[model samples]
Target chain A: MGRVVSAASAIRLDDVTLGYDRHPAVHHLTGEIAPGALLAVVGPNGAGKSTLLKGLVGTLKPLGGRIDRGALKVREIAYLPQAAALDRSFPIDVFDLVSTGLWRRRGLFGGLSKGDRATVAEAIASVGLSGFERRQIGTLSGGQLQRALFARLALQDAAVILLDEPFAAIDAKTVSDLLELVARWRAETRTVVAVLHDLETVRRAFPETLLLARRQVAWGPTSEALRPERLLEARGMQEAFDDHAPVCAVDHAA
Target chain B: MTPYDALVAPFVEFDFMRRALVGSLALSVGSAPIGVFLMLRRMSLAGDAMAHAILPGAAVGFLVAGLSLPAMTIGGLAAGVAVAVLAGLLTRTSVLKEDAALAAFYLLSLALGVTLVSLKGSNVDLLNVLFGSVLALDDDALFLLAGVSSLTLLTLAALYRSLVLECVDPGFLASVSRSGGPTHFVFLGLVVLNLVAGFQALGTLLSVGIMMLPAASAAFWSARLSGMFVAAIAVGALASLFGLLGSYHTGVPSGPAIVLAAGALYLVSIAFGASAGLVWRLLPARRHRAA
Candidate 1:
């Protein structure tokens, strides 16, 4: 019942280097995310999975090489930061919170039309939060809040959707429900990239995977990228990395 | 005393009392909602800091213009915005957090302001700047209060949606639109403007009282932002009315009386309000039927 328009485009990363304080966190990454691609980014803790998503969402600028979005504006990309970044105690309800997704459509001053209200309701129902419309978001459990966030993202109607640990700490039922929504996005030819920890969920739901440990460990089909040896290599690489290392040389665009 | 003799007669007989009531009512409409937003943003004390930050500027204005409304207001606005911007810059560039930076600047500002006020003016003038002369509000001051109230309401209406998004999920708003940072700065400007508006009737020290007391009290009664806004304005207006009357009858300072009235409401709300009030905690939980 929800028909939100999303223009499709491929995202190209040419030796992208993302970092803080000139220190590379996710360095020397190069790849193209084709339109309608459903990809999972897997890594150990501090392996720069979240950093990569930040780079894609344009919150963090690449310290070295460029990320080419072709023609997509940063506003047209939907990003769900980790739950820790959210302030749940702010006084707002489920329906109002979800309607914030229409920011790009309605903008800073435009009022939501009748059709827009119906679309918001549909998005809420799709997330199984039909009756919780008037409930304050602070009262929502983590899973329910995540579902509400997904509903908000659905209304964003963006070409590229990036999520940082979207299913972390979620129940299996909630994870399954959210995954179905992700699949529906893929069916609509929207690009979906998620930072994930659970290998089992990745193997089941994602066809393509980028296994990373501050650098690309493997990038291919999920089965090949998540092989046992590659995972071990990722872990070893993460452990051997020095936290106090000096800034690395900047990459010259090839 | 009869109801008319006690409540109605003070305002009817004394022109100054009527002016005081109208001035504070304007403050209630303009400043209280800003206070609600401040409370929601978890920046309640930040409002207090900003109020103090305006002191040195207003003091300078007083020194130069001898209590001219325009001079003191411009000075107060400049000082408040300068401190806000400086503190914001420090938070961005250094390890100092926004609160710590603001505290440091405002403490110095309060010292400078008081020193400036005491330089040329008498103790009475110092008391006027510190606690306000609400009963002596001139036409210029009244006009300033009304203008600021009208402007604050209009600006808030235009910025409502973005302000909500900025408060609840700043990062999300930053992702989708460029309004997040600009909206926040504008909200801070509104806070300073309201405080400036209130300073004439309530003074720099006590002005924030009218803003914060009612807003914080409203939190006890409601969870919805709209409800909180209504409750806060109601509480503020009631406090202004009673405080002015009480001041006329009791021979106490009017500014503190008004603020104290608001404080009393806040305390009462804490005990008996509808949402998470102390009384609710003391009562037995209501049973919910299983579906």
Candidate 2:
């Protein structure tokens, strides 16, 4: 029943269950992502949002069931872990960090070719870091560091880009700029899946969405999947509106 | 004769003195890069441990076979690599910290080596192994040092980028398509080889001092990798030359003399070098007052 499909149908997860040390985080999750789609995964704290991305990226193995791609290899996927995941004291420049993306193309001993250098420069420019090639990574600000990591992702030139909470602790301007870049990636017919906590940004940016809270609550277009009833169900609230919770405006287009 | 003239005259006339000076310079240059990586990986103690572990292997070679430097060197390298690999495996499999494993391997090796040397009927040779005599260095030792240093430099130059990447971002390197296993082993092998080759001149105890001190001091001056490598080599070569000359004039042990010279450089770097040094930090404060 598995077959290579068009760009509109790229990743398919069938009955996938994943967890850490036998503790199930995501259970019986079934979904499919289309190419050129901007999908946002949203939930509250400890909602298995990051764990689902880890399972998709092959960093964390699935506990049961199968995660099948139409015809994609693991290397064709690019992952941007949390900003705090990196070692700041490491003595590497922006150029060195970005060049690591080319490791697959230029084996271990092979030097960066002229073409590779051009791609590196283009990727740096794409992230608005044109003159940051020689700057040490430890010297960058939080926003600049996030952009530098985005530059590395651009250099990876993969089909799917998976970002885990890249917008956290960043300023509003940087958030908009990063989302705009993700929109551009979608324009190029690539897949963009981000683990986001801001529901407002999720509604404004991502067309399709997955609402997760230890289990798959809803998986469909943002307008249909992020309804008030579904959100209340996912949040484990009997009453729809509570004094502490903010009201959700669910679009009915889907 | 003036003290300067007396010291200068012996270095010019003595062939053994010339060999000792050149041999120390070559060994310092070869070992410093490996030391840089070792410090970055927080495996500086492992390098120290492996250096000490080679002594028992050397003593065994000397006791079993004739007293041949090459045979001793080969035997020592084998033992050092074995210790490094075992420690690495233990750290991976067990709940032990890397430093704990290193300490255990090194102490056991040292005790075994001393016992083996005592069994060789000449415990006095252990002193020579502990504190080497540069005056006793011969043409064969010079040639061995030169050849090993050249091979190490060539290998480092070839794998420089990958090794640096591995040191800085091992997880990222592992996520990429290239296999990091072989490169990791090659880097470890280079460290083992440098330790074994330089063991004759610096001895086990002081070899790590020469390897680590120069690179550690150089980091205070430069942020660039190539700059750090160049600065480390300069510090190492200068320390070796001055230490050799000072030992010849003052009748001191060559190993301690070299270590003292390196320690002096470290002090100077900490006090005066730019970037991370105390002097640089004080400059902004002075500028604020002056402005």
lDDT of each: 0.90, 0.79
After superposing candidate 2 on the true structure, give the runs of residues whose Cα lies further than 4 Å from its correct spot: A1-9, A236-254, B1-7, B93-97, B284-291
Error of 1 at A240 (Å): 7.2
**lDDT (tens digit, per residue) of candidate 2 on A129-215:** 889999998898999989888877776667788999999999998889888788777877788999998888999999999998877
Q: For candidate 2, report its TM-score.
A: 0.90
Q: Which stretches of candidate 1 lie over 4 Å from their true place?
A: A1-7, A240-254
Q: Please give, for residues B1-291, the per-residue lDDT of candidate 1 as tens digits.
A: 999999898888989888999999998999889999999888999999999999999999999998788999999999999888888788867999989999999999989998998899898888878888889899999999999999999999999998988788888888878887778788889989988888899888899999999999999999889999999999999999989988888989999999999999999999998875799887788897895
Clashes of 2: 0
- Residue A10 lDDT (model 2): 74
